[model samples]
Target: ATQGVEENIQEVVGHITEGVCRPLKVRIEQVIVAEPGAVLLYKISNLLKFYHHTISGIFGNSATTLLTTIEEMHLLSKKKYFFNSLSLHASKLMDKVELPPPDLGPSSALNQTLMLLREVLASHDSSVVPLDARQADFVQVLSCVLDPLLQMCTVSASNLGTADMATFMVNSLYMMKTTLALFEFTDRRLEMLQFQIEAHLDTLINEQASYVLTRTGLSYIYNTVQQHKPEQGPLANLPNLDSVALKAAMVQFDRYLSAPDNLLMPQLNFLLSATVK
Candidate 1:
C-alpha cells in the first residue's frame, strides 16, 4: 500500500510538471517563431486542451474541477455539452463537503496556493501571440486565488502551537511576496498594488508576532498567576495556568521575535517597485 501510494504521488507530480510545463515551454517558443496566424491559433488551442486535461486529472471528481473545466472550454461552443456533464459531477462532489470550515494551517493553504500558481504560470507560459495581455490575465487570476489564502494564513498563525506553524507562516508570506513581485513586473505606476502588497506583508508579520506574544507567551503568565492564586476567583479554570508552560512559551516567543526580518520581503518589494517605474 505504501509503495502504491508513493507511485501514485510520483505519477501525479509527473503528470503536472510534464503535461503542464513542457507544453508551456513549447508554446512560449512557438510565440517566438514567426508562424502563420492559423497555425498559431491551432497551437494555442492544443495548449489549452493540455492544460485542461492536466487540471482535470488533479481535481478528479471535485466540484472545483468541474467549474475549472467548464471555464477552460467555455470559448469552444462545441464542448458546452461536455462541460455541463462535468459540472454535474462537480455538484455531486460539492454535496459531500458542503460548509467545510476554513482550513487553519500553513500546509493546506500553501499547497493550494502553489497549485494555483503552477496552473496559472503554465497557462501563461504556453500561450502564443500577445504576451503582455496573457501575462496580465495570469496576474489577475493569481491575485484572486492568493488574496483569500493569505487571509487564512494570518488567522491560522494566531491559533497554532507548533514550531512547524511558524515555518509554514514564513513560507506562505514569502510565496505571496514572490507572486506580488511578478505582478509588479507587468506595470510600473501601480502604486496602489505596491502599497497593498506591502501592507499585506506587514499585516502577516505583525499578526504572527502578536499571536505568539499574547496567546502563546502571555497565556503562560496568566496561567501561572491563576494557579498560584487559585482561591482568588473563578479564573482558576483557565488552561495552562502552570508557571513552567508560561515561561517556556514566553522564551520561545522572544527568541523568534528577536530574529532579523526575513530578507525575501525586502528583495521582492524592491523588484516590484523597480518594475512599476
Candidate 2:
C-alpha cells in the first residue's frame, strides 16, 4: 500500500510540472516570434539566461522540459539576431540607385549603412554575451555586415574618374574605419580597413602627381625619360627633351606652387582624412 501511494504521488507531481511548463513554453515562443530588432533579441536572451539558472535551482530535475525549451529559445534568438541583422543591412545598403556625389564625399548608401551599424553596435555593446563567445560573434558580424558594405561602396564608385573614385572610396572607407574604431573587438577589422585606405591613398597620390605633371606641361619629358631607361645613354642624349623645356616646366610648377589653392584636384579637396588632405 505504501509503495503504490508513493508512485501515485510522483505521477501527480510530474503532471503538475508539465501543466505549468506548457504555458511558459508557449509564451516564450510567442515573445521570440513577435519581437524584432537585435536589441530586443539580446534582452530576451538575457531574460532567458536568468530564468535558466533560477528554474534550474528551484525545480531541479522536475523542470527538465522547461529548461530544454528555454535553452532552445536562447539559441534561436541568438541565431536570428545575427542573420536578421545581416539581411537588414544588406537589403538597406542597395535599396536605391544613389551615386557618389560630385564632391567625392561618401555616398548616400554608405551613410545609411553606417547609421544602421551604429544601432547594431550599440545593442551589441550592452549585451551580456559571454567573453569566450564574443570573439566569434565579432568575426561573424565583421564578415556579415562590414564586408558587404565595403563591396557596395566599391561598386558604386566604379563609374567615377580615377582620382574621384579613389577619393570617394577613401572617404567611405575612412568613415567606416572610424565607426568601427569606436567599439571594442574591432582591431583585425581596423587593420583591414587601414590597408584599403593606404592603397587608395597611393592611387590618389599617383593621380595627383600625374595631374601636376600634366598641368605644368612636364608629362612629355617625364614620359620620355620613363621610356628611355637609364640603361640608355645620358638623359642629355635624349631627343627633343632638353634643359630649356625642363626650365619652362619648372617655372609653371613654381607659379602653381605660389597659388597652392589651385594645385590639387577639386575632388581631392573633400578627402576625409586631414593628414591625407
Candidate 3:
C-alpha cells in the first residue's frame, strides 16, 4: 500500500512537471527572450507544489535507512556520475528561464526544494544512531555545499526590495538554521556552522555592522551603537559595534557546546577573535 501511494504520488508529480511545468518554462523563455508580459505565475505555483510533493514522498520513509543508503551509494565508484547526472537532469528541467513579469520577483521554489531535499536526505535521529566515520564524512561534504548557499540566501533576502520576497527569504533562513541544528557532528563543525548562520543573520540585523539593516528590525541596535560611540579619536577609528546582539547569539549558541556534542563554539570564537585582532 505504501508503495502504491508512493508510486501514485510520483506519477502525479511527473504529470505536473510534464503537463504544466514544461509548457510554463517555454512560455517563460518567450517572456525573457522577448517583450514583457505576465509570466506564468500559475505554472510557477504548480511547479512548486509538484517539487514539494515529490520530495516529501521520497523522504516519507525512515531517515536512518535513507541516510545509510545515500552513504552506500556515495561510496560506489560511480557515485559522482550518479550525482552529476541527477544535478544535470534537474537543471535541464528547471532551466534558467526568467519570469515574464519584470517584477514577479525571485521564486522561493529553489530554497523550498533544497530544504525538502535536506530533510529527506538527513538521518532520522542522530541521538539514537551514533554516526560512524563514513557518515561523519558525508555530513561534512553536505555542510560544505549547504553553508555557502545559506549565506547567499540570507544576503539575498536582505537585499530583496519587496516585503513579500524578504519575508520568504527570512523564513527560508530560519528553516535552514533549524535543519543544521538537527544534524549530529563534531563540536568544531557544529560551531562553525552556527557561526556562519549567526554571522549572516547578524549582518542582516546589526546596525553598526550592516547598512542593510536601515529598514530592518535590527536597525535599532545600529541606532544605539551610533548614539553611544565617540565621534572622534581612537573610538572614531574603531569599527562600529553591536555588542548586544553579538553577545546574545554567542551565549545562545554556547548552550549547545559540550563534550561529545561537537565543540564548534570555542573553536569558532577563537578563529573569529584571531581574525579581528
Candidate 4:
C-alpha cells in the first residue's frame, strides 16, 4: 500500500575521500523527514561514518574556532545542567544512546573532541596515518584548545559559589575524563599538564561538595525558620541570620540558583524548607 511513497525515498551505497584522496565507501539507508517544523529519523548502516562527518564539521577546519566553540558549549552546558533540571529533548535522546568508552559529549568540549578522535581512529583516515605523527598533532591541539578551557574552568571552579562550583565540577569532570586521553603522548610537559588538571579536579570536587552540602543545609534551616516565623524578628536566635541577614542570604541563594542553575529547584523557596532536597 505504501510502496508508492516508499519508492520516493532513498537507500543506496555512498563513497567519499579525504586527507589525501583516500577513498571511503558507505551504504546509505532510507531517510524519513518532515518539513516546516519536523523531525528526522534514520537507520543507517554507517553511523560511524556519519560521526566522522559530524566531527569534521564541528572542527570547522580550524583549531582556534574549535577551541572557542567548545568552551562556549561546555559553559552553556554547565549553566543548563546546574540551573535547570528540566529534561530537554536532546537529553532524553542521550539517555537512550549508548556511548562507547570515554562516553563523550556529556556537553563538554573535550568529550566531543575525544569522541571525534575515537571515530577518526576507526575511520579510513586513520588507516594510512602514522600514529606518532597523529599523536603529535593531538598534543598540540590539546595544548592549544584544552589548556585555555581548563584555565577558565579552573578560575570559575575556585571563584564560584557552591552552585556555580557544581556547574564547574560537572563540566570539568567531563573535560578531565576526555583530556586524560591525550596522555597518549608521553612528553614530560603533557604529563605535567595532566597531573595539574587531575589535581585541580580533585581539589575542586572536595571543595564544591562541601560547599553544596553546607549551603543546602543552610537552605533547609532558613526555610524552616521562615515557615515557622515570618515575623520581623530573630527566628532562631542566630544573630548572623537575623531578619536582614536571612533576607540577604535568601536573595543570594535564589540569585545563584536562577536560570540555568535550576538544577537545585524549579523556583526559589520563600520558606527555608526542613531540608536541602
Per TM-score, the best of the predicted structures is 2
Candidate 1 lDDT score at position 3? 92
Which TM-score value belongs to model 1?
A: 0.33
Model 1 per-residue lDDT tens digits across residues 1-277: 9999877876666555445554544554445243323223334544554555565566543324333443344334213332232233323332332221233223443555455455445545665425665555455444445555555565555554443344445455545555545532434323443555455456546545545556446744644564566565544355664456656776766765576243122222322234321
Give candidate 3's TM-score: 0.33
Candidate with more favorable, higher TM-score: 2 or 3:
2
Report the lDDT tens digits of candidate 3 across residue range 1-277: 9999978876665554445444544554444334221112212222333444454456443232333333333233123332333344334324442221223222354454455445433522322222464355446445544554544454445544443333334344445545556655534555664566455444333322333343233455546656664554443343443456556545544543332134222212212122221
Highest-scoring model, lDDT: 2
User: What C-alpha lDDT values do all the predictions have?
Assistant: 0.46, 0.78, 0.41, 0.39
Model 2, residue 22: C-alpha shift (Å): 3.6
For residues 1-277, what per-residue lDDT tens digits would candidate 2 score against the true structure? 9999867765676577777676877887787787566556656775676677787777666667768877777777767763675667686776654688877787777787777677767666665666556567667767877888987888888898898889998998999998999887889889999999999999998998888889998888889877887788788777656778788888998988898668788778898889778
Model 4 lDDT tens row, 1-277? 5875543331111111132122221111112111111111111112322444465555434333333333333333223331122123223333333322121113343354445434433332233234664465445434544454444445434554544444344444444444454445535544565566456445545654445535644555545565765565556575555667667666656665674244332112211122211
Q: Per-prediction TM-score, please? A: 0.33, 0.81, 0.33, 0.29
lDDT of 3: 0.41
- Residue runs of model 3 more than 4 Å from their true location after superposition: 1-78, 85-107, 123-130, 151-155, 158-170, 186-190, 200-277
Ranking by lDDT: 2, 1, 3, 4
- Evaluated against the true structure, the overall lDDT of model 1 is 0.46
Q: The CA-based lDDT of model 4 is what?
A: 0.39
User: Which regions in candidate 1 have their CA more than 4 angstroms from the true location?
Assistant: 1-105, 160-169, 179-277
